[model samples]
Structure formats: structure tokens, C-alpha cells
Target: MSEAKMNPMHELSDNVAVPFEQARAMPPSVYTSTEFLEQELDKVFRQDWLCAGRSSSLPNPGDYTTMEIAGEPIMVLRDRDGSLRAQSNVCRHRMSTLLEGRGTVKSIVCPYHAWTYNLDGSLRGAPAMMHNTAFCKSEISLPTIRCEDWKGWIMVALNPDATPVGEGLAEVDALIGHYGMENYVESFCETHRWNTNWKVLAENFMESYHLPVCHAGTIGGTVDLEKMTCPEGRPAFNYHWILKDNTMPLTLAHPNNTHLVGDDRNKTYLLSIYPALLITLTPGYFWYLSLQPDGPDHVNILFGGGLAPEFRDDPEAATHFKALKTLLDEVNDEDRGCTEKVYRGLCAKSAEPGLLSHLERPNFDFARYLNAKIQGEG
Candidate 1:
């Protein structure tokens, strides 16, 4: 929507730098340029291993979810044998999108042409192809996409040879394994569209500087900006940890907040897996956002979150989940204002990139990660 005002010739790379203090945030052009967004679809998102939420969301044999990555429709399904598969959601017959949202289906039946596919993507039925000997049913199948289940989170890639998400997050697992994230059961999951570039949210999630100003009514009181530590990560991810203050209502002690051996027990790690996964983990709970660009000014956010297993079964779990989701919504409302305003301001003729805060060190790290991908080094 804001595309008409963007400078097509803009190069955000010119505005960004290293040694964070010496660096500037990505220029407004990067966020509002339609040309750059198209490049991102092919260079970054499609080629990178992007997350597709949790395996637990589709634990049943036939449970499935439909996703769109870099504009490609995808079907993430669990077959009867218990293996998860990511296949192109387009049907071979007429190239129609096979599924819309998510549900348990015995088989994928095209609503338009009646072409059916098995849980594993094998063509199960063709309405009128039996007489055509040239069209072999056995040879017809949906294109398979590369997918993986890393510690219960499903990650998929359009590129046949993208880096494995498990390998990318091995160090992350080793670092936060004590949190027992595998035992974290999702109490809430949702997808919402934001009227801003995906990068806005990515950077917002990485820094602690905005908490006091943007989220003052919610998480702001529970965190200290000076305590944030942004550390470099493997090629596929970057992370920062923030010390928790005792003031916020959300920080109350829970019986399930366990397994941490030391200082980490008091800190929450905000890890952004390069390209598009954001995972926030504390001792008692975890939440994440799988960001996807819909257009230059639009982003589709896939979010998932839950508390540790020991907390979910509590009699108050339902009420607690409701409160948790409400709190999250409030935080998101604050973030939305910042991102949307920034995006709108970027479209102005006077908008220019500015210096980064030390708190934005992680944000700059992500910018470098993006630059490498834009240069084909990823």
C-alpha cells in the first residue's frame, strides 16, 4: 500500500555498518521497496530454512497445516506412518491450491477438480485419467519440499539443499537445552497480518530498547535494558539474553519453571534464527514468531507459544493461558504501533537511516546475516 512512495533506487546496504555503535539501522528504503521485497523472496526466504510451527500441532497421523513461503503454497502433513512431509500444495491436474488452512483430512482432495493425494503426497485418485494411458497415475505426485523436525518445531525450505535447521540450532539447543523446550506444550497459536515490513518486527523482537517506551504497560517493567547481552551466533541464527526484573506480573513464580543450573535461570534468551524464525525462551515458558513477507508493506506472522508441561496440566492452566494470550496481545499491540509508524515514516521523502543503539547489536548482526544472503554468500 505504501509502495507508491518508496524510492526504487534505494540501497539500504549503504546505510548499515559493523561495530554496532558505528553502524546504522537498515534504511527505510529496505522496508518499503517493492523491488527489494521481490528479491528477498528468492534470495533469503525461499533459500533459507524457515520454520512452520510445532510438530505437536500435527501429532495425529492425518493432521496437517497449509503454509505459504515466499509465495509458494505448502502442505505440511503427517502421514499414517508418523513421518512429517512438506509438499507443494498445488495440484498437478490444474495447478490449483489444494488446501486453504488446517485440519485432519483423510486425503488431499482438490475442491476444484477432484484430484486426490494420499497423506504422503502420492496421487491417490484421478477423476478421469484412467483411459489416458499416456498419463501414468503412479508417476503423478505433488512436488516434495525439504522439511525437518528440529526439537519439535517443523522447519521447511523451498531450496532442495538449504542448511538443515537442526544443524543451524545445535548450539542453541546445547545452550538452552536445560529449559526443556521439548516439554513446552503450546497453549496458544495464531497467525495475524501486520501492515509493515517483516524486518520491522524482526528488529523489534531483537532489541530491549523499545520495552520501556513501547511496552510500558506490559513487559516493560519486568526487564532491564542494561542487562541485555547480544552475542554472535552461528551462521543461521543470532541471540541476546536479557535479565529479568522482579516487577512484572508475568514473572511470578510457577511450579514448572525448572532445570536451569545457574544465571540462565534468571535470564530469557531472544534468539532469531537468521532469515525468519524468532524464538523467545524463559525457564517456565517459550514463544516464537515465524515471519513471512506477503508484500513490500505486508507481513504474515505465524506465532506459537506455550508453558512448560508441568504448568499446562494445572487446574488453572486454562485461565492462565487466557491471561498469557491477553498479555501477548497487549505487547503485540505496542509493537504494531512502532512498526507501522516506522513503515509510514519511511515512505516520506525526508526519512533517513539512523545510528543503532548498543541494545540493537543483535539487530545489526541480523542485518549482516541479511547482507550475506543478499550477496549470495548464504
Candidate 2:
């Protein structure tokens, strides 16, 4: 039998085992197989430290946000003592979910039974349980999960034994730290569902090779393809950069910004954190997408962006951000169209992956990352 007729998963393993210079795009089955997706949910999503959102959004003690990781509902919040906490979002009494979306709450109260929990995941009160001799409020708190704040991003891990977020991102921090990314303020965060595999959207963000074509109507006109560089990726993430003069002034360093020097001022970094956090970081602004797989044909996305502190106080800040938001929305629409089309093609019986370009180095690394994780190498 030919290589094309071999087992799909084994073919993927062989493809990733090759070098970057000889790499091909991952097989269609990587995105189209339900069995493979189930493995990804367990090995990749469940074992990784996923980005929740910006910690700045939870400045107040009662502020919290909820998300589901590999079918496990979790909430990240600010405790009363000014600490970050991650815990099960399900109520202990009847296993009902305690929160939805984002909001401020004095205490968690399950809508189903009004079982109250403190911000620290402690059981503050449980009505009518006093009569049950078997009940002990002290031992009935929500289960705690591993949570951490790395730079500005709130990270939560479903697996207790996962590596610390900072250790894996040390190199990324060193590269982008001068910009004070931790101080960047989030302007908005919204959740949306897309009709494509999560990996499809992720691979789209990892390369700039398609920008000039896929995003031509939006921000692609400003791109100089030759000026882009895709270097070998680190174990925890993959990144690429486009060094050029930006058409949007807000994307470049502000006049008042003095920290960044030379090319750093004009650098646009595309960072893909393992599993599913994609970030576009520029000198003056940043945006990100946190992806969750719903199934082989769908993904849940948490999309957000914000401005650096230097740009926030500018006289025309509001107008600049308003225009920036509009542009990003257009870019997102273009990406949606391209990735959804790719998914449709992958579903076809004749779907086959083509050779990868030099600009797609990150995608190759991502494929390797996925393969390693799924094979229990990590």
C-alpha cells in the first residue's frame, strides 16, 4: 500500500517526524476525525494550562469569569484577599453550574438550589442541610484547580500536575517583556462560535503566508511578505514576526513610548501558545483568541483585545481604538471565511494536504507539538 493509503494517525505521526524543510501540511483527518478530536480533548486541552483572559478584567475582588475546558466547567475569580482562584463552577449540592459568562458576585449562589459558596471556594452556607447528620459544611467546598497569572493573562490548568505557566513561557516573556504586556488593559472580551475545527483557526493565526491574499481587503495591503520571518518554535509556543512600518499608527509604538528601541518599535509578533491561545502583539496594542473545540466541525472562541497604557491617555485614543476595533472585526470576518472553507475542503473524500511554505514553520512546529502531546511524550 502507498503512504496515502496508510492509517491516517500514523501518517500524521510520520509527517511531523520529518524536518521543517521537508514538512507538509497535516492530513485532513487531523481536523476531520472525531476519534482524533476526542484524544486531543484528553491529551491536549485537559493537560495544558489554558489562557482564560486578562487578569486586569478581574480587578475587583468579586469579579469572575467562567469557561469550560474539556467538558469540565471552571471559574477564575479574584478572592476577597486580592488573590486569584480557580475552582469548579458546578455546585456541590446537585452538580448544577454556579456561574455563566462574566460578572461580579458577592458570593456564588446556585440558581437551582441557592447553595451559596464564598469567593474562595469555601461553602459559606447551605440551606436546610443542618438537619442532615452526614453533612459537613467544612468539607463541602468546591474543588480547587491549579491557577496562575502569567504576565497579564489568566491561566488555569485542569490537570493538577501540569507545568507552571511561567516556566514554559519564559522565553516568550523575555522577547516581549520590555513592552510591559502585563500592564496592558483589556477593552473587551467576547465569546463566539465558529463552524471550523479549533486547530484550523489556530494554524491560520500561526502563519502570515496567507495575509496578503486572505486579508487583502482589510489589513493585508500593508504587509510586505518578504519582511516576515518564521523561526523555529519553542516547546511551549510558536511565534513569527513581521517587521515593517504599520499603516495604523496605533499598532506602532506611541510617540511617548521610550522603552522599545529600533525594530522593536515596529515589530508585530504573532504568538501561538500551545493547545489554543493565539495572540497578535504590536507595540501599541494587542489582541488574542482563546480557542476551544466543540467537535470536529466547530470551535468556541474567546476573542479580545486592548491598548497599551501609553496609547490609552492619548488625546485621540477613543477614536483610534474605535477605528482599530472596526478593522479587527473585518480581519476576523475574513479569517472566518478562509478557515471555514478549509474545513469544508478537509471533509471531502479527495482532501489532501499540500507542501508547506517557509512562512509556515510555526504550523509545522504546532503539528509536532500536537503529535508529541497525543503520543504521551509530554
Candidate 3:
């Protein structure tokens, strides 16, 4: 909660300026180079705690979900006692992937060989070959990964030596206590594969610079751009964007409009957990945006929204939910369209990393954070 002790490795070089005055765009290699992307998989994704799935997916014992972290197939399953456990999807014998996607399974069976593992990743069975081969069933278990469920979100880590996920995200939990995210249920979820650099998408979400240009129709009229301010002295680890209630009519009126409008105004706070997770806290709902890179120029964006318990069952709430989704979809389409073009432009030799605007302090701060991490400064 106490800011998670800012990555201690961050040290300012004499030449490096503080209170960054300008925004500098990232190099093209960051987007188009396979080499850089691979380094990211190792240096960043593997070492950081990533929001893999929602806890609701694995609510009951035996429920499981397969997730890909830094291209490694991993599975999270609920044990018989209802505790969540994560293990490599690779078979211990031949190293073939175990789970395909997500489903309930009493036990995991490897397709290549009949190597069966329990929900806790212990070897439960190896039908025939075990008798002939000097295989120790106790030692022939699937490798396990660190798994943690906090505030209804499931997080996974690839590196065995990485810091505990609870330590990394402790600050975030304390910051959103009032939201009571853990109590909210997952109302909707959707995923889209976009052709854009993952960092580009992440950086875009960290700032509101493009809102007026891209989301003018949906959120432009609804949010007040002037009131938006990125906290100073914090290096933009998180952000709070203030939005005023619609001067224009609500595109779709919400069921309980009382809490929707606060003194005829509303504020939407957008917070970006460094690296990949973005959380949008609104009066009526909470939306989570998680980005996972497929390649240097490709990314998968997962959208999850949580609704208050009372509204989850109300029919009118459904209408507002659909409206929110439509509104967000429109904004997402715009971002994807623009980022894809940015990818193309970055491929051009004439293109170079551009500077950030003063208004884009959040993006600049995020870029600094990433640059530091990539350089092993954090």
C-alpha cells in the first residue's frame, strides 16, 4: 500500500533530467524487431506478475484455466480443497503441452504420453511405461508456477525467483479499497487480437492524449478533458483522470441514475498498473484492460468488466451494460485503427521515436519506467 517501495534499482544519471519536460517516443525496434520482443519476454513479462484471468473462472474445485505467459503454456486449477494452483502445461516426460485451453478436469492427462498429474501438479498416474522405465512418480511431476488471486483477479509469474505477486500489487489493492472489487462479480469479458505493438497499446491507455481525437463521439462529450491531471512527483506509476457528467444526454440511460450522476457531474479514474494492466473505475462499474503480447507487432487485449451485486440481476442494468460495452468498443476500435497505423509508420525508415507532450505526462512517465526496466535499472 505504501507505494510498493518504488523499484529500488531506479537511479538518476547525472545527464538524465528529472520532472521530465518532454515526451520521447520509443524506438522502432521496440515495435518491429523480433530480437527486442524476445528480450521483453525474458526481461519484462517473465519477471513481472501478470493478470492472467478472473478468479470467477476457477471458483469451484477442479475448475481450471490455461494461460499463456511469455509464450509458455501455463494452467491454473482449483485443488480439491478449493485452493488455486498454477503449473506448467508441459508434460514432464516428453515436454509436450498438457492443457489446450480451459475446462474442469479432475486430473490432467498428457496427450503425448499417458502422464497424468493431479490438480496440485503431482504425478497421479503413468499407465504402462513407468513399469519398464526407472521413473520415479514422485519426481516426475509438472513444474509449478507462482499463482495468486487478489481482489478477484488471478495473477501469474513465470520466473521462480521473481518477487511475490502480492508484494508487487500491494499498492494497487490499498488504492482501490473503496471500489470493493473483490465483492463485485465478473459481468462480462471479451478478448480481441490487434495488430499493433503491445507497448504502443499500453502507452496509449496510460494517457488521455488521444481521447479528444479518437473517442470524441463516445467519451469526448461525456468527459471533461481539462480536469484531467496526472499526479506529480510520482513518476506516473498510476493515474487519475477526472471526467464531468454528460452535458449531452446519456447515450443509454442507466437503471439507477442517482449514483450515476454526482452533483450533476461524474469522474472516471483511470489507473495503469505498470507494464500491462489498466483499470478504469467509474461510479457504476469497474473495467479492467489487460494486454498480452503475441509478437513484436501483435497483441491480445482482454476486456473484463465488474458490476455491483445489486445491478447484476436488474434488467435495466443490462441495458446500461450493453451501452457501456458499445461505447468502449467504439473507443477500442479507434485505438486499434490508430495503433495499427502507428505500427506501419514505425516500420518506415523516416520515422523516429517522437517526444511526448506536457499533457501526456502519464505516457512519458510510463515510457521512463519501461526504459528503466528494459535496461535492468529496475
Candidate 4:
């Protein structure tokens, strides 16, 4: 079979069944409507296994991280017994948010009324609440949440009955197991507020169709569009691979990460884990972006990743990292411009859905994922 014929990833004919040449893009309101955003928060973010950060970040007991998902304040921490726990960051006393950011905490204390909780979500103390017989301080605790550690990724789900993160992502785990992602160290963690819808960045990360025009000076030069291949999209995620020569600078192949063979050694994998997880894995290095939709017009990005262990110890690692950051910033600036302009155009009165390129199978999958959540089929 021809390469295109063998690819199960596109599944264009079987799933959507509309020929790519006849497929139209999603309506622009899907990106700009306030009503749709609310539905997504409830159906997508609240029910899905949202990636938090690396498990290594919370290695020690009491070490915790905090974030706001679907408007609910959440905390993930390591308890004294050395297990992971997720809980609401809202104080039980007066509903005031309990934590601001992340750190090791012996106990989570509410700044407003002095209510305190142990790392396990147990009520530690309720200062000055003993005045009334009706008050039951010992019985109150922060509402616990569901959390799981999958490989090195930490994730939490707001829904009590949500699928276990490990079981939920089992297919993805086995699909890319050769990467040895568990040992990958997170060299940097940054939060950037971008003036673009989260989906714009999400789709950009998944497709190489825009490389020649968008990253013309950098990555575009290294990739041969003809050599690019889109694998079939799995139920949990989507991936595409493109062959690049062994001489690329930013991601020169490393010894420890060389298990992939055939075109795999020369191939770079661009993967999207549904709604918000975007990862780029090469034979040498890797990085990822976990997106948080701030609103219709803004996205908060959690971006960072680095070289495999072998490359991390390189004498020139600092120099290489600095150059990578500089180059990445340029590419990011270009992407931000594209997405921001797209968002602005989405608001135009004459805006209409456009055609989908054969290269944009990822976007088609994204549209399908959104449709599923919105229609309660996923």
C-alpha cells in the first residue's frame, strides 16, 4: 500500500467520510462564543484527566502544586504516606481560595479566616471556631479530588467518576513507550499569557503543513514536506511524523534516545493528547506545551522540556539551551501572530469556515473531539 493509503491516522474516509477535498472548516463561533466555552469547561476540562506537571516536581512529601481548572481551585500534593492526593483549594470555613501557587506545605492555611488543612485534606485546625456548639471543626475537610501519576506526567480530574488517568491513557502509554519519557527531566517551567485561543496553538503544534511558510527560517528548512506522514489518530490522541536529516541543530539525535529505527530514527513525532496536551519528540530532545484556556481571546501556556539525560550533561548544554530558547521565541512570535490574527478574523462579520487541507487531519480530529464533548458522545 502507498504511504498515504496505509495511514490509519487520517481515517478521513471512515470517520468523517467527507473527502478532504470537500471538507469545510468548523464555524468560527466554535472559537469565539462564550456559551461554547462554558460547555467546554463543564464537559471537557471538568471531566477529562487534565495534565498538571511532572511527577518529579512533587517528589517530596508535602510538595504540592496548584492551578485553577474550569474555575475550580485545585491542589495536587504528596501526602505524609508518600502517595499523591488532589483536593479543592477552597477553604471550608468561608469558601475563600486556600492556595495561590505551588510549594511544600505542612498544612494548607486559609489567609482569610485561619482555617487550616493537612496535606491529606484533613482539617488540621479551625482557629477561633470553638465558640458555638453547632460548629464542628474536626469533621470539616477540604473536598478531595482524583489524581494519578502516568509515567512522569501528573494529572487530576474534577469528576469523581472520571476514568483513571493511567487506564484512560493506556493506549498512548504503550504507543510511544520507546521514548522512555519517565526519565525525561523538566529543565524549565514557564507560564505565558498569549492573546490567542488555546485551540489555535493546539492545532499549530500538531501539523507540519504550515512549516514551509510559518517557520521558513528555522524548522521549515529541515523538514521535507513530501517525507511527512500522518499516522492514524487513536481514540485518546493523534500523531504525525516527518523525516528530517540527521544534521538538525536544535534536536541532534542523542545516544540514549536512539531506539527508534528505520525512518523512525530520522522521524520526529508531533503528538496532541486531545484537548490541551501538545508534545514534540525527536530522536535527541523533546518539549511540550500544556494549554489552559483563559477565555475566548486568551490562553495560558505551561511550556517546558529539555534534552535527554545524556545531552543534559553536555558541556555546551547551557549554550545549546540558550540558542534553543532564542530560536523558539522567534517561532512562537510567528505562531502567536498567526493565531491572534486568525482569532481577530474569526470575529469578522464576513468570516466563514474555510477548506481543510489534507495536511490538517489533526484539526479535523480536534473538531471531532469537540463535537463529541459538545454532543455528550465522548
lDDT of 3 by residue, 224-307 (tens): 567777764143256766655655323312345443344322556678876788887665566787888998778987788866
User: Model 4 misses residue 219 by how many Å?
Assistant: 1.7
Rank candidates by TM-score, best first.
2, 1, 4, 3
Candidate 4: regions farther than 4 A off: 1-17, 256-258
Q: For residues 1-378, write the lDDT of model 2, one tens digit per residue.
A: 576546666777988978788899999888988888989999999999899999999999999999999999999999999998999999999999999999999999999989899999899888888789999999989999999999989999998899898888899888788888888878889999999999999999999999999999988887798999999999999999997565778779999999998999989999999989999998888999999999999999999999988888789889868977998899999999999999999999998889999999999999999989888987
RMSD, every candidate, angstroms: 3.1, 1.4, 5.8, 6.1
TM-score of each: 0.94, 0.98, 0.86, 0.90
Error of 2 at 163 (Å): 1.2
**Alpha-carbon runs more than 4 Å astray in model 2:** 1-6
Off by over 4 Å in 3: 1-19, 233-236, 247-265, 313-315
Best by lDDT: 2
Best-to-worst ranking by lDDT: 2, 1, 4, 3
Candidate with more favorable, higher TM-score: 2 or 3: 2
Q: Return whichever of 1 and 3 wins on TM-score.
A: 1
What are the per-residue Cα lDDT tens digits for candidate 4 across 1-378? 466433322322234556555666666667777766787888888888788888878889999888789888898999999998989989887899988767887888889988888888888788786677888866788888888888787888888898777777788777777767777777776678888888778888888899988888767888887888876577668888887876565565565444766666666788898778888876666778888899988998887777666567778878767776677778777887777888888889898777877788877877777767766888
Tens-place lDDT digits, model 1, residues 260-349:
546765678888887888988876568899999988888899988987675677788887678778888888889899989888888898
Q: Backbone clashes in each candidate structure, one number apiece?
A: 0, 0, 4, 4
Give model 3's clash tally.
4
Superposition TM-score, candidate 3 onto the true structure: 0.86
Candidate 3 vs candidate 4, TM-score winner: 4
